[model samples]
Target: MAQPALGPAEAEGPCSTPLESPVHPVDEKPAPSRLVPAALQHIAAMYAGVVTPPLIIGQAVGLDQAGLTRLIAASLLIAGCATLLQTLGIGGFAGNRLPFVNAASSAGIAPMLAIAETSAPGHQLPVIYGAVLVAGAFCLAIGPFFGRLLRFFPPLVTGVVITLIGVTLMPVPVSWAQGGDKEAADFGAMKYLALAAFTLTVILIVQRFGRGFVRQVALLIGLLAGTLAAVPFGLADFSAIRSAPESLDDQDDGEGEGGQGE
Candidate 1:
């Protein structure tokens, strides 16, 4: 009643045939058409965060309008390169290759402004840059060894770190919504709160009800909506950019003086 055993070729044939991988939604690569929009959305989300740091620190260090513009352009370029390195990586050792967006941290603003405050008037920016260079070198040198400490932080401890970061940053939004500077007379004005609420409501509505690309670009749309809304209230002002110099040489004369230095 027992069947005869298969030959070696028959047995090996079944084993040698390639097994197909199961298609998983989670592992699926998005089409290039859809991929671009997804990336832009992430850029939209992080744009303000990346731009604000350079603006704040550059102004605090007493950069002129021309110098501030150069700082902002440099910041954006560096952030883009950092993000690419983080997501794509060089070989296997350099980058995390995660879905993370790397940019300048707002957390450093206080320390940097403190540095600027202690420095002499015309010398502040040079000192701040030197400090930043030294700090960056120290961080890079310690990174490999410091990564080993990750094992010491359980989920609870990690959660505490996140909570502390959020708690510390919570005041920044409150200050922004109250008209930026805490010492200003209009620091707790109702107009700013109303503007912020209106912007939030518009963003939420677009995100919740919009379909396809509308939903994807809600942040950008909300910003446009908010700017238009601000016009009636006289809150938005862009006079500085309106008065920008005609030529690039004049705009960034500091760099134009020398052809290209080492």
Candidate 2:
């Protein structure tokens, strides 16, 4: 009653293991030259998205220039802190130690605007803040359960959600192409349309033909190229940079004069 012979794989026992996938060099710590551009590319990709929420809310709340500046600064600081915490997890506490950029979510804009509209003048922001705090706490409380529930979302559902998001955001680039201001005299100028078309073409070309980091940063490259092209068409304005310091100085002088008079 001899036993049957074992298969080749079983004969090798536990020592026989599948070969692990090789890691590409680009996945590792890149050179300084590559790293800087790659980092700048990520910044370019998310910069507008990161600032949009605060910009819209600040305008809606009637914040002054200085106040808007502070809001933007604070938003950037908090996002940076959150990104650090996420990448460098605390001891048995917050963060998943992943590479993620945390910023003000555009998803909350509608609800925030509603809250602002419902609140009294000069009190809208406070109400919005209170609501945000409660929402944050609620999210924290349900974090574990929420993660568990994600298992119910199959790839089909996830793909549909992603497609829906892309569809929803399709108008953003269209708005940008229309000069970003509906009231502008040349809102839908042919030049702007051409610029957008050129940018999209560049992005497509890069994605199709470029290799390595170039392909990875195609969107950023397209953005930069479009900006450069815009300058020649009088679409890129640098007047704000020149006026910002003067505005700050004027604000400071006004404040000082008021204090002296008092």
Worst 10 residues of 2 by lDDT: 18-27
Per-residue alpha-carbon lDDT of candidate 1 for residues 109-162, written as tens digits (9 for 90 to 100): 777778888999988878888988999899888988997998898999978876
On lDDT, the candidate that comes out on top is 1
Pairs of residues clashing in candidate 2? none
Give the TM-scores of the predictions, in the order they appear: 0.70, 0.67
- Give the per-residue lDDT digits (tens) of candidate 2, residues 1-262: 9999998877887557644334455346778997788777666556656777787777678787677887888778887788789878897778987666676677677677778778899998889989999999999899878977987999999898767655655665687788767889989989889999999999999989998767866877788899999898788998756666556678788879989999
**246 in model 2: Cα distance from truth in Å?**
7.4
lDDT score for residue 160 of model 2: 88
Residue runs of model 1 more than 4 Å from their true location after superposition: 1-19, 22-29, 155-190, 196-223, 252-262
TM-score, cand. 1 vs. native:
0.70
